[model samples]
Target: MRRKHLLNTFAAAALRIFMLLTLGVMMTLETKADISEEYPDFYTGAEGTNTKGINFVQSITVLAPEYCSSVMGDFTVVFKAPGMKYIKAFCWRQPTDKNPGKWGHDAVLADMELKEGEMGKFVVKGDEFPNGPMTIRIHAKDDKNKQDICELQLYNLGGVKWNQGIPDRDPPGAAGMARVFADDFDGPLSISPDGMNARYAAHKTGGGDFSGWQFSDPHGENQPFAQRDTFLRIHASKPLGTQGRSGILSSLRPDGTGVAVSIPSYFECRFVAQSAPGTWPAFWTLTKNTIGMDKNDPTFEKISKMGSDELDIVEAYGGYGHKNPNSGGVYSSVSHFWGQPKPDWNQRKLADGSENTDFKPSSFRTDTLQLGGKSSWSWTFHTYGLAITETDTIYYFDDIEIGRHPTGEVSKALPAWFLINYSIGGISGWQIDMERYGNKTDMWVDFVRVYSGCVQAPEVSASGFPGAKPAVVTMSASTRGAEIRYTLDGSEPSEKSTLYTSPVSVSQPCTIKVRGFGKNLKPSPVTEYILTTPPGVQGSIGINFVTDMADSEQALAPGDVTGIAPYIQGNWNNVLAGTKTTSRFSTSDGATSPVTLNIEGEAKPEKGEPWGFSGNDRRLKRGNLVSNPRFTLAGIPYAKYDVVVILGAGIHNVQGEIHLAEAESGNHIDAFSFDYGWNGGQHAIATTKPGEAAKNTNYIVFRNVTQKDITITMKWGSGKGWTGVAAIQIVPQKD
Candidate 1:
């Protein structure tokens, strides 16, 4: 029974082991199959197609690419949409380093719709991303529903990268800097045989070069054609002569059928003398009619009608120490206006202190300063330029503005062709170098650049309080050819704004907006100003007074008393008075009685004839009391006031003096004083006080009065002056 049981158990155990082995084998095969289906070998469209029918489904991936590190050129993505008239595709990118499957918001690529039955490929160019792993997603819409798909990998193969679809590298040989205009001339111009050829070659080569045009006697053999007034004269020796000529081999003359190029309204012309003992070279513009024609020709009427203007862009006289004559420097730029005769051009003083009074009709002269130690006349290639506009004319030299002339009154007849020449020998009439006659000196021409039109000034605005009549404002601008226009309304101004005939009027407060338009009709920034009306006032008055010697005593009174009795009794010395007594007298019925005192003595006049005592008692004798009393009333408003003064009239020398004080206690205010003789009179001197009410009740006083004067009289005494007494007072109106 035991043996049979053992056999069964063994059989059961074997069966279990076999079952376990089978299950293990199945699990291993399942895991291998799952990994193989989930992850396939990475391939980019650039490498080749993975499977034809099982399209890469670019719509299922990011817009750009993944693994674009090796991407070069453009990849054509082909896809199809069924039953749709039109289809559109958009591309996006996902970085493999972070959020490998998630796309970013910035669209790296996009494309318009593709027509039905049209099989198009979207190009995935290189440089879309830098060397890195990226996932490209594409969305395709076919009318109704949208289908999204993707590609696994793409790359930049040409060492280029793209971040957000922008190239990662700059183009080869790009320095990332701006180019500057060539303004400095340091080398010699490359010259050729022919004059025109030399100028053209120098311009092409772009340095400093010379054309074989001389400004000496053109009739001489081996010399170019002598074109009078058209050619510039270049001299190697000092003190340029009045008469210098040169030859210009140009078949075209200013009067001929040559093309008329408009002169710029603004430009700079600069010339440099290359030699240290520099030759003064002058570039002048002359009317064609002035050339080879007598000064008194009948046809000159037609010729003179062709007005010509010249600008002395620069002039360097050899006598001016090898430098420019005008500025006493190496470079000088000046402008000339010659439409009509003017003092600036025809009457200018030369370096020799002589005036150039003879009008050369249509001639403009400029020069180049000296440089280095050579005697060469080196011209700035394009240093000087001219501009002509409908409104004005401007000249420039070496990029610096020389001058400007308004064309408001002048006609706009364009100038003919220009000439460049150098002069050698001439008569010593204007002091030419006789020894250096016929010296070979060259005037180099680099290039001539002509521009047209004028630069206008900026615009300005007049803004202030609204509705206030008489509102004033000032407008300013910076420009060469602009006029100011303004409007009072808040509305913007067009060409129709009120033209600023003059400064704006501010009778009423208003907001005025202003704008400036250039010759090109372009408006500038608006400038603004605010204006307001002033306030007003009511009435006016003035005051005047006189002081005598007795008045001085009243002024020196000890206290602020209005009456003068106490001063006479206490200060008067026995030398001026034999006795002193008071009498009752009154100008008005007041609580106090008015009293007059009498004093007598030998009062003498000092040398300046009608002499009176110096009101400064401390500086005079007892018999001749030096009493001149002057007072400044403080805190007084200018108004009218009643004034009263009394003087004692008797037989002693007495004269009165009075003066008005300014608002402040100084000599800054004006003063007026008068002398009076003591003849019996009602008040010796009195008038309504001027300049408001006296804040400090102060008055001028006199010294030598000795008697009572109910009747006041003033007289001039040839002998000892008379005596006077009493008081002065002022009262305000009750109103």
Candidate 2:
């Protein structure tokens, strides 16, 4: 065993050296020639409508000699509509016999959106289109509703030939829970619902607008960027093309067949909530076959009872009325069987065949889950999932089990398809304040996944996978061939982010996050590996704590590192639990009112780094704090190199002075301070304002004047205040 371990270590060292030498070369590989030049007539025709007076399609060319049908994550869609703004394009495998209009049931090869006359270069991921006789549609719209489109050509990057090599994607979940259904809405919700019911019909309760909700924007903005996200927004608004309206999407296929799953499965979707008072967003499943039909008919009741099984995985309107308990964001789930009682046709029945009219206790029941904060559901993406088994049905928020129900007869009910709607003004008596909430509310969906067969997510065991070596952890792909992307700060991976070409090297105990990417495979779940350092692996020790729990940065003094406030008040507990964009690390101050400053991951250093902490948990972000922001720390020096601070945030054209001082002697050492004047000087990373639509705030590197071993304090401030500084690592370097 010892010999093998030594051999593994040496192998790892060799691999690392090899990769270091080859990485630069790999990054420099150029894209192959255009498919249009290589494969002529890939596209037979292209057209544009509603463009006022402009020709929408710039050009259409083919790359491979064949069509793209089942090929994705391995091809690129290239096009341009320079004459028009707001382009919405869809590329699909159009069959030789089926016309473009009949392309409904066929899979969408790609969904691309371009805003403000942008080029197609930013429209889609490289080589993501499938192989087949392709049909392309470009819906270009102006701010005033004028539309246009342009033909697209394929550009091959990575020299990926169809079927020449395998596709890279997230592995499917484990067996029994393996994925049975899935859609990122990469295109439109091609599947239609059974029929229009009361939910689809406009409700008078809050003057709701039915038919107002939409799928991917025909006007752009629905495009998820590779580095961030591309999602479909279910928007609720006061009539644009018409009047006050809400949105609804049925899961029934337009071909008349229902989309209900025939077996027990899980339905999961990541949604950005529209949590205002008047807005009601929900993810629910119903008996697709029986919906919009008469429940009073006995035959309908018996055979259709199979169709009336309804599961409300999430109803966001539950937070209304109960101000205290429901103060924070909350959702409700209910189970219902519309099989009416034998004699009482007006009442619904339970699994046991009983009828309860007044309380309707058995007819329908609800379970509520408080989401902790009022704004909890409004800002970020949270997953709501329904796990349906033969005997059990469960609801989840961000993967944590929230409510459960016996499968009873409902579990035995027919298959169900998901219906996502942004509703409003129902008669349920929830609060309605559209005037206060505004005329427009948006609900964004990242993806919807349905699974059965006891499938679990890909097992990401640091121990089990091959490439078994010290400091190297391999993630198990779901038996399906795929490539994985990873991050250290817990954010989900994006196509634009770094690709995991090989197992990562971890010198610190930071969290390494992994996610799979596959072309035709199911959605790959993000798996986090929380590495623990060996006792001997500890780096240089330094004090870490939160200086304040307020929204603003507090002044840092020599003794304020620990003694200034109790640890409890610092709200250090947040770092202990992590959930990607949420959770933070802090030093609490008990004397304070258990106050906390929230700093999501990426904004702070790994838990073990010396001086690794957000100063104000509530101030998890210091990039925008401008009023003399200061940070102080004292520790045994890690080395005698010059002081250099690595800062991660957005500071495009900002200038500031960073001050460094010796904490114990209160001495401003040699070459103590440097003024950060970006936009012209050498920049490590430059970006726009922080917390805005822009990414990263880009990391900034500053070389300090002094180098020493004594505990040090550093501060950055500008007359305009500060940009965001998510986290700072004091690395040893002079340049």
Candidate 3:
């Protein structure tokens, strides 16, 4: 029994060894198969009826054969496991060098257990891997003992490619590239938002986007020179299709006064290219009829019946360095003329020695000119511009002029509306690689401008008075070649109005109308003004006083009262005094003079009383006799009269009255007087009345009627002695 049992144990151990060896062989075979092929073969589980195992393991890895120049879409890894009791899959980013080994770097593990004897697949998308050369490790583990690993290589592939070649045929041709129709106008183009200094409108497809175009007018004063002067400016966001050229258009009309259009010698249009992997944008002008140039010559003739002129401004190629490089650095410029070129032909040079060359066209090319030596033109932004004038033509890129044309008088009048566009490759020599540049390249048009003739003012007129000269009438044009027309009839002036040769002369009141007209028949608004001269004046008046009297006493004393009084008397009687009863005194002579006295009078002197000279003396009393006794001299001559009164006696309480006669009519004059009192030194008085009659005697009477016994003497005319008189005379008026 013991021997039998031992043998049984030995057999069992032998079976175990055989089983382990078989398993190792199967694993070896599986590994070899996976290593020999790009994809791994699936392993069956331990169930013979289902040769599957409880735990199965499978793995996969991807290796990039070589670095891909370009990559598109996503990279993927796929695998399937069949006949496994259950399976779990794991994927990890691995280096090509470490394929089919433990994924040491960052990795994602799928450790899900599956049902017995089930089939499963594992897939990993490309983005999961790194950019450079890489590998993907895919591992599948099932319920069975089998484990498998597979490695796949990854590569880089770039974007799609495309090409736009030149046009195979030509479109119909209109007159010259640029033509100014006779119907064009020279007046200000009426812009909607009236006062706007400068503005531009563009026509584009696909909902226009102008972000790519940059605009700048450093000097804010001047308007951008557009159709009237030269061309428009455009820039591209990507390589433009060269299949068709771009177009820039303009229109002109008479403002109001008349109908005429003035043209410049030359004009310009400009464009820029997108600096991308592959892109080339070109600018060109074409007749309105041959937009695509699909129609033949006969078709162009039919279109020409509609009146249109076309011109190509510039064109460029983004690829080929024949002129520019594959990287994009080439440009070209050309101008088309309508009929015969003008006398001072070349528009590039002005008579003033200034360059008329357009800076827009050559600006972009010169910017990348330095890159021309390189194999590929470095992708970068570019700018271009073109300017044309009656006497000159200029072309520029980014403010840099690349070309110029000296042909003067390109057009006698401004050209009709023309078209401007940017094309990738078209009739012009432009061939661009669309693939390198992407699907679409953007072309931006900043604006189009026209600068033509200046507006002129009208004539002015003056009227009413003689020798009235018309105000200087000044006029100016927006550009040039504008003539001023004016009339003095107050009527609106037209083109037929008389031309203003010089300032108008006005001797009488009149209204003037003025207007400005261009050589092309375009007219400006009429300006009008009314003028009147002033009238004249007549005869005058003059008067003067000649006197020998310098001193105040002499100037105020009466001529008849010659002497001064020394003593006080009981009844002081002089030619200046009058009796209380009569109340009047007459002067010895017809002349009159003024006098001063110290006395009292119950009744003041009457007209011509106490008078000594040519004028009457009328005494004017103040209040009642009880109050202060005050009197004024009256009836003085129409001329200046001087008077002086003197007191020679002791202090006396008395009332004094002095009077003068009025002068005759037509007498316009003035008077003055001076007085001297008894202890009180001197004083003065004067008088004059308009239209008063002159008289012989003017007197001043004094009556000693005070309660106290007062004694005083009076004097006039130098006031030396009691020459006595109530009045005096000194003058006959002089002029």
Local distance difference test scores for all models: 0.31, 0.38, 0.30
lDDT of 3 by residue, 1-735 (tens): 000111112222222221222233222223222221211222332322121221222222222222112234453333344433323333224334554332223344344444544434334444544332233333343333444433222332321111111112211111122222111212333221111111222222111212122111111112222222111222222324332222222221111111112333223332323432223344433223332223464665554444332233444434321222322234445555434443244345677878856422211223233322111111222334444444445555544456655423323223323333443443323334334222333333333322333343332322112231223333333334567777778888887888876655454556767777765434655666554332111000000011112312112221111222211111112322232211122222211223222334332322111111110110110001111122233333334322333222211222222333222231212222323233222212313222332222122222221111112222123323221222222222233
The TM-score that candidate 2 achieves is 0.31
Give me the displacement of residue 45 in model 1, in angstroms: 85
Question: Could you estimate the TM-score for every candidate?
Answer: 0.24, 0.31, 0.25
- On the 0 to 100 scale, the lDDT of residue 36 in model 2 is 32
Best by TM-score: 2
- Write down the worst ten-residue block by lDDT for model 1: 535-544
Error of 3 at 192 (Å): 16
Per candidate, the number of residue pairs that clash is 122, 79, 183
Residue-by-residue lDDT tens digits, candidate 1, 23-72: 22111112122211212431111111111011111122222332112345
- Report the lDDT of model 3 for residue 731: 23
- Give candidate 3's whole-model lDDT: 0.30
